[model samples]
Target: MKPEPSSALFAGPFALATLSTPDGPEFPALVTPDGQALDLRDVFGDERLTTLDVLDRWETALPRLRAVAADAGPARTAVTDLRVHAPVAPRQVFQSGANYRQHVIDLHVAHRAPGDERPEGERRAEAAEIMDRRAAEDLPYVFTGLPSAITGPYDDVVLPAWAEKPDWELELAVVIGKAAHRVPVEDAPQYIAGYTIANDLTDRATVFRRDMPQIGTDWLRSKNAPGFTPLGPWIVPSESITDPDDLRVRLELNGETMQDESTADMIFKVARMVSYASQTARLLPGDLVLTGSPAGNGMHWGRLLRDGDVMEGTITGLGVQRTRCVAEGAA
Candidate 1:
């Protein structure tokens, strides 16, 4: 029971997507600026051509895609009639943490010791100063994510019974087009194929290991649950975005605005994040690099997710994805 967004999903001449009819096999697709979607089989003339295959041949396929968008004609289908899936099935997922200046500052201020009563202004200032130093002198913190956790953008998010504090984290996802290993920051853009939206759900209750305090956060349990990451309706080509840093990242909970911020608040920008990740591991085509989420998560507001809550997320030009929260084992 999802509603259509107010505007076109993406304003680009064309974008990449994965779609299928009810009970039909998923296939790579080309989406027009007007919201018409055409299966890429027409372009590839091969049933085996998948979304990742298209990404693997992005350069050779770009011109063909543009031509198709200009003349979709009779082959076009309205996007509403199709079941959209996550655009690419990545072999590897690299996610950034505490990458937003305000998000970290807010979290630091909010989680102060119970008995220690520092003035709000003073606490925020101290956190802000620390963030500034980290931004200037520290490397971006990144971690791995499981591809099995990815679900379709509009899918249901089942809150596990054991998860006491489930939360939402809407972020911009970067799709790799070229294989990059130890790539320089200036050259990171060439390795990026496109951008998509991802909602990185977390179970805050499992974030810290109470039994082994020295071991610190338990990301595997806290962040990698099945269907924890809801990703994409489409992959908007990097060329379509004039300035990724200027885009707005927003999310609404049951029609109430929750997380709303600009990419400008990021401590580590897209290019830098990609370059940093590449220095440690090779980034292959279709792999995803998730920019950290912005401030205004459920933890910040002291109101976590509940069954039947609907989360609608949107990144400027990348489109919107609506996910309903369902308690585990609900019919």
Candidate 2:
């Protein structure tokens, strides 16, 4: 476990990362503000250190790691030399859908028929009314995501040959530190380990089942593609981030800002989403719960990912993640 104190400045703040050393397999590392990587084992003096170990012991581990970060100097290895892995390997991943107010409204407007003479303002007002009703009702839309879809922050987003409209939906992902089931919204934050960024890549063309319209969204076929969820470069402990809702979420496609909104736009913010998810299932340590994507998807822009497109996503304190699109079969 070696701490690199000489790496270049990272795009933003981060606490922990899973990285592969030049000669070793992937391992958990503490990322310092100095942009250096500190092997958790070396810092904690434990050889069996892993990201999960730190998360499960977050009550005691985070503070110690922060103290080390406060004094970390130049990185030991060039930041570019390290290979970043998804900061976590969660046993279960829960995702919220259409959670952002404006995002869903945009989809509503975009999907309206061309011949419809309804005013845009009228449609938006109606959608807003529906969201208000939903908020009052306290129901959050959630779905399951397979860990097999997770990938490193810098990995390529493969556009499958069969997927014609592969699009990006960047989101704020919450990491659970404690087992929670039927927890109230007020008590939800206590179980949060930290936050990371997730680009919830979707296959727009397959969102609805062609053969079974009544069956609705076929998320498995449209979303669970290999390397679809380009996760964290690192995880920022929950305590470090003052307010998850106030953070900014922005994604640039080919250097153009597409999705730019705050988590505050979420109809059911982090706590409610967590609490809602807990109502049905137990959330364990290291579980990844996506808070939902906020507007600005390619579907609204009339464009979709192609083999050479590049996407860069950032969520406030979380660091940036760049993923280039590639044809599934291309080398």
Evaluated with lDDT, which candidate comes out highest? 1
Native-to-model Cα distance after best TM-score fit, residue 270 in candidate 2, in Å: 0.9
lDDT of each: 0.90, 0.86
Tens digits of lDDT, candidate 2, 110-225 = 66754778998998888889888999998899999999999988888788899988989999999999899999999999999889999999998888877877898899999999
RMSD of 1: 1.6
Clash pairs, model 2 backbone: 4-75, 4-76, 5-74, 5-75, 5-76, 6-74, 6-75, 6-76, 7-75
Q: Per-residue lDDT tens digits of candidate 1, residues 1-331?
A: 3327445778588889999888899999998766778989877898978999998988888888888888847478887888888889999999999899988887778667557698989999998998899888958999999999999988999899989999999999999998999999999999999999999999988888878878988999999989899999889999999989889999999999999999999999999999999999999999999999999999789899999999999999998898999999898
Weakest ten-residue segment in model 2 by summed lDDT = 1-10
- Model 1 has a clash total of 0
Where in model 2 is the C-alpha error above 4 Å?
1-14, 71-78, 112-125
